[model samples]
Target: MLQEAVDNFVTSIANGEMERSGGSRNTIMAYRNDLGQLCSHIQTLGITSWPRVTHEHIGNYVRHLRDEHAYRPTTLARKLAAYKSFFRYLSQKGVVTTDPALGVCLPPVERELPQIMTTEQVQTLFQLPERDTPMGVRDLAMLHLLYATGMRVSELIALDVEHFRAQDAAMQCVGVRGNVRYLPLTSAAMDVLDRYLQHGRPHFLRDASETALFVNHHGERLTRQGFWLIIKGYARRAGIEALTPHKLRHAFAMHMINSGMDLGSVQELLGHAHISTTQFYCQLASAQHR
Candidate 1:
């Protein structure tokens, strides 16, 4: 059956009803529903069986839940746990050649970081902006994009519309001596960017000729100082007097490291020219967790 594994995976965590997984009965039921929804989704992609599922398919499903349904990080984490269990069972039974859900990354757990914003603080700052106003929309976009990309403030302000790839949900960053890197956007960042591009940017544009993706009240490319003020304004409102763009970048790097992202991947995402530059985050994460 196309949906057989979804059903079997319910008690698969325990191997059978007699054995017990630490998860409660309700969690097993929730896992069953989660896998069932995923199966229903993939079948629409013309797959007649679970054996055809790929890592790409699982990634797309996660992105769909993120971008289309706007699932929160905690909710996504639960669904990912369900996927991992179901796929583990599938792989053990030879129903699939390999585990397709092995690569799905859940959010870094909430933890205390010395001299860094906690996950709750970050969420507070992100949710502080009022999205209805043009400036607010732009601010939220910048905040989300900055946190999502871990880009320097100068780089963020330097972006043009052409640098963003809407279909892939990524943005290009040009660094020293014309070095170029493309960074993937989080679904939250993508959603805010789309809203800013479609609704907010128009209000700030004095001329159609302006190509800057982010603009100030005068309809010109935003300066680093301008971005500084915008961020400070929000931070002050949130009672965070010491906030800076670099702090956000630091949080992004260390959180990824602590969440088990490889150092090479972190280096690439941060556009660090040397792996050595990215290695400190490992120590930093350890220190924070300690």
Candidate 2:
């Protein structure tokens, strides 16, 4: 019966319930998976029914996810969100008297000031890409756009050829929440992109109908894992430890803020819906000057 309830909940998520409510396919799947994990954990507690699960049981499950599963804080936060939503649904249906996941404080997440590369470090990293080869040209373009636009890695990989306004030297980046914004590219970045499009992309193109701006060797759109490997390789080659694509984004934000760009403009450029999110870079830039 417990498994039946869990399966029904997952089915609801998969059957357009969440989709109609603005949840993406990825998001709905993630919630289903997270809740499934929670249900599995509950079974281990010898509880066969949802009503038998107490608030304390949910707390124990959270601790189990943290200690035994070694889930990261961000991941844990999402799992908690899933738990809350699921329990709220159960409560509304009279399956449970109260929301067990409610009033449960999340583990504190450390908001570390993002790491950023120095201008010299960025220059060194950019030089490591082998521009003589197709893959090299592609890497150069990806890396250049990463730093030039401060876009999230997901946004970078999702870009299509049409997204680039080559005449204006800008690219349109799509946010996870469906917000779209244009990011201006540096002349140097634009030059590398032009070279990659003309010389590199055609070499990797296996399908004439593919529209992804960047493609892997398999001629498919690049994945986040693939880009992570690429960035890690270049960072290692540049002799920079702990550098990530996100650090490049941080570098872009810091550089812009330090170069006298206004906070509102930086917020817009970074596609930050909140000014508070962009303010952190200002603090990072201030610390650098100090």
Q: Evaluate all candidate structures by whole-model CA lDDT and list the values in order.
A: 0.84, 0.87
Clashing pairs in 1: none
lDDT of 2 by residue, 1-290 (tens): 77677667667777766346656568878977887887787888788989888889888888887899898888888888888878876777789897788787776887767667889998998899899999999999998998999999999999999998999889999987899999999999999999999999999999999999999999999998899999888877788999878888898988899889999999988888899999998777777778
What digit string (tens of lDDT, one per residue) describes model 1 on residues 147-253?
Answer: 89888887888899999998989999887546788999999999999999999999999999998999999999998889988889888988886898888999899
> Predicted candidate 1: what Cα RMSD to the true structure?
19.7
lDDT of 1: 0.84
Compute each candidate's TM-score over C-alphas.
0.60, 0.83
What candidate 1 gets wrong by more than 4 Å, as runs, is 1-114
- Candidate 2, residue 241: Cα displacement in angstroms equals 4.9
Best by lDDT: 2
